[model samples]
Target: MDDTSFLGSYTVGTDAGMCCLWQPEHFAHVTSYDVWEDALGNDPAIERSIEAGAFVPLYLHSDGVYQVTLRTGARTPREKRYTTASSEPYLLVSKGAVALSGIEAVGADLDAAETIALAPGRYAVEVHLIDWQAEPGSTDADGNAVDGALPDFVVEISPEPDPAPPYRRTVETFDLPEE
Candidate 1:
């Protein structure tokens, strides 16, 4: 059995859950699963690469319409792609109204740097928006200039490559502290 916690701890380390292509029928009794991708490497390929990768941006019971398009510097899909997980610290507001919580990432490629599973409550999640001062450019998928004002972009937690980030994690079995 995997005993894990999302609330980060300074005294110890974290063990990113293992992500595998397991057959569903083999584990029918399993309530849920945690499928972690490769370790958050030294540097996420998305940080500097100009490839625009698309994915399910927000966290929820069911993934919504894919509206999150990361890496805005790419001109084509094959030029840059979403190959692995990103360690970038994106704002993760609790879905319910709560002061603190632990949100553990379960997908094959997802995580919140520190352990902060959400507590039982409500929260309006929204990434802190960033006002970047840059040149104004209008362009379409066909590489044509368009007329419109770019909305302020949010600064995300820079993601690292599949290589493990600067951290240590492992699965250990031990006696639990007595109440």
Candidate 2:
């Protein structure tokens, strides 16, 4: 079967619902964009390909974020589609600390607290999707969404860790009046 491990997929009702919930491994250097304005409309050159069922993955190098947008006419039903993959972003660990770990939807807004802290070190990280495979009928015989394999990411920490952020203490002294 084709590999869709790096792609997120789901179907929404006519009322515009979410397809799936996916939490990116790291939150640093993450930013959001408007699908209609930024991805599809920004570049008029790629308009033809996009309309031809091309779901391109947009990479934001500076922000360390990746986005894939799918747009369908109101008449055309939304369906799952797989596109090309690129260099995925990773969590950067410099200081010996990570801040957060929690479930988040793919298109949900992210904040500073979305990060997880780890021991101070240098690392290269990879992200993966979890058990979110939809059954043929969208439910198991018992009438529950099928749970796929456990999703997890990997990280390689370096022995020679970078120095932590610099620190400077301030000192204040007052001269007493001499009698």
Candidate 3:
């Protein structure tokens, strides 16, 4: 696997007041698929990746494409306020193309993320995270100033079911002299 293929770690944690390192999976090459075109939306690069089996769509939502999952770290059901945040903000799986797949501000401390069904295979993946900044007069649903950013990263995927290679088939026929 190449060092340039990864963006960073998917999750970050604080231990005894120390920041952990960001270590994500890596892959030498990727095999992309366009399995979410209809459900999501369209992108020429995504289509090309699928055709070439170079990368797959993990999450996408922009310019009419909406495909992602909501994640809220809140545990209590009656918590008045629960803030949601995420690392792994944006992704660029193609050779040199970048894509945004992070969630926007909703309410009730809800966060957004992407989900994909894999066929069990090793994949070169791009991981996206949020890099938030404070806006002077911005306000969220809960009356808090909105601050967020989209940062892209990369990782390697290993599906359990292991995806099948691109479809290919052929036929052969033989003929005998009217025996």
lDDT of 2 by residue, 1-179 (tens): 22322222222111111111122333222345343234323335223322221211121112222222211111111121211121232323335443222212222243422333344554333222222233245457776555542112112222332553221111101122379
Largest TM-score belongs to which candidate? 2
* Best of the two (1, 2) by lDDT: 2
TM-score of each: 0.18, 0.25, 0.21
Model 3 TM-score (2 dp): 0.21
Task: Name model 3 segments beyond 4 Å from true.
Answer: 1-45, 63-121, 124-156, 159-179
lDDT to native, each model: 0.23, 0.26, 0.25
Q: What is the descending lDDT order?
A: 2, 3, 1
In candidate 1, which residue ranges exceed 4 Å CA deviation? 1-105, 108-112, 133-179
Candidate 1, which ten residues in sequence have the lowest lDDT sum? 47-56
* Backbone Cα, N, C clashes tallied per candidate: 33, 10, 23
Positional deviation of residue 145's Cα in model 2 after best superposition, in angstroms: 4.3
lDDT of 1 at 43: 24
Error of 1 at 33 (Å): 9.9
